[model samples]
Target: MNLSPAERRAGITVAIFCIAAAALAFGLTLPLLGLLMERDGWSRSAIGLSSAMAPLAILMVSQFMPRLVARFGAKRVILIAALSDAVLLILLKITDDYYLWLPIRFLMGIAISALFVTSESWINEVTENHNRGRVMAIYNIMLSAGFASGPLILVVVGIEGWAPFAAGAIVMMLASLPMIFAKVADPPFEGTASFSVWRYFLVAPTLAGAMLLFAIVENGSTSLLAVYGVRNGLPEGEAVTLISAVVFGGMVMALPVGWLADRMDRIRLLVMLAFMTTAMAILIPWTIADPVWRLVVLFAWGAAASSIYTVAMALQGERFKGADLVTANAAFGTIYGIGSLAGPLVIGGAMDYDDPHGFAWTIIIICAGFLVFTVIRQSMKRG
Candidate 1:
């Protein structure tokens, strides 16, 4: 555990770049897949189903990730993930059939999940407690900024031909090259006893709940925001930018939230974030047609909602380390995948409503569910 200052900086740098790369692939792929399918006459339901495959893969694969990392090392896992991610992006162009997309998307999910688990575990390993909040905040910002940049790239490439797919594959490969040169220490898995994921859940149910809720809200929002915007009469270009607006909020606002996390009560901050996010979701329906106001609300929505994950993960790093940290993050990825699996379906089903604002309502309901859980969790802790 004794890392010199130079090693620490290098490790931190590698982890950040790895995470940013993984995140960029996710940001680029998710919307592009949905939009392309829609353009080819796929139903909202079918498109939503296709999107769910990735999360399903994560939920199934994440349980074994800790062991895989132990056996293979995080750096190796990351390299494989990046390489596989590139291959998967290229594979998407081989077919236009939704059924064919299901398995491809599932493989895509596994690649991204591996990168997610390895990168996060690596980052948590290198970061110290004294500045964990700020570190994670920076991590979250980079991740969000990567996510925001995807739509902007999509704007240039357009969702038409092989160009977007090639771009995605190329960037993923480029992300792997930097890590090939850095020597990241292997995780402490040799003497560590394998812990049940449920044990981690029991130790930190509130944080676990936060991860699940964040996944549901985050995926649901990013996936459908453009569709919702278009349904509400915004141009396709404007609708797509709404996602970037939200991500931009997360990119800029996460730092302040992280600074506050270091200084304030984290549980209380989480509650406040949930409350603010819910309020923003409710306002989306009202602001749907007002482009300027909608952008403003989406920005704030992104800031609050994304900070929940940032702050919660900082809390995890504060409390857990080594094998336990791996288990905790694996648990998080599994739960996040579960929520991600459901988010689009729930939102897509809600969009079936005659009201164009149903997408916002779906988000509100999910946020309310999280808010209620946090309140009850707080009450129980006090009792």
Candidate 2:
């Protein structure tokens, strides 16, 4: 798509705003809620269940996004979603009832899902094919940066009272303002919204697999890695830092990973990264005793694992356009939601059953599965 430079800039701005807002809200809410619930004596299982509702909402809401956009336009959908999210964050702060929080989180998921789909579809629509990888890499970097910044914000504002909630609402409201003023035109929705999960699978099974596995690993690790570290004997502060190391790895490695995708066959690169990630996961059990060494492993692991999603997204743009692109992105979100929904349960179960090493083993198993599947998939294609 040959977009005017002005439109391209506006699209990038909007995309950045959407991702940053989502990441900030996510970063603040997850830890804040968990901490709040823990203080209130809620069980870990209960907290996890409350967290799961959002992804479940995303899974349900994503399928209808194409239709929503078709009827209302991407700009309106995104603006409404962001504003609604800001409102929900404030509501979550006021509500002390656990049952009330669950439904509110579910609604937040729906709103955020709309923002995610529209933002990604918009970015794909505006970017030139040749520059897609790097542009997406930058997007991912901003995303990681936003997530990484959230904890810092929490520390500054303190997570105890209404401060963090107010900050999150303000950030989301700011995110919405750009949608109203950006000159970027929404991608014209053509025909009816086609949101078949199986159809996207048929179009690109490898992309589908990448989306699912990446979400599984990413969500699973983010939710449990610190717990795993603590179980394995690391100090609480150090264990938490492990997650930061991983996020740091993702942010630092973005450009190089994107450069490789732009220059090489993305499938082969994905296979290579999968192997590297698997190797790193296997090393974690051995390295867990040494904080520095374990952080190194996580750093490498984050880079390789996170790159899989980056490349998969770039490939989506390479293979599809127009309405197909919109549908495919919705499919990506749906697949990701499914993975996110299941990842924590699976990994947390394994951790409970096996204790310290279970987390590493679960991740290793998932990474190894991806590596083996990709190799076999490619070999069959060559035949």
Best by lDDT: 2
TM-scores vs. true structure, each candidate: 0.89, 0.95
Q: 1-383 in candidate 1: lDDT tens per residue?
A: 67876777788788888778777878889889988887889897788688778889999888778888888888888899999989988888987677888999899888888888878888878887767778899999888777767766788998888988888898899889878976766555445735667676778888988898789878887778888999998999999889888878888888899899888888899999999999998899998789699999999998998999999999888877777778788889899988887887788778986457778888888888889989998999999
Model 1: pairs clashing at backbone N, Cα or C within 3 Å:
none
User: Per-residue error at 206 for model 1, in Å?
Assistant: 0.8
Model 2 residue 383 CA deviation (Å) reads 1.8
lDDT (C-alpha, whole model) for all candidates: 0.84, 0.86
Compute the lDDT for candidate 1. 0.84
Candidate achieving the largest TM-score: 2
What stretches of model 2 exceed 4 Å from their correct place? 189-195
Off by over 4 Å in 1: 31-46, 94-100, 154-163, 189-194, 230-238, 289-291
Residue-wise lDDT of candidate 2 within 11-102, one digit each (tens)?
Answer: 88787778787888877888888888999999988998998888999898887888788789888898899989999999998887798999
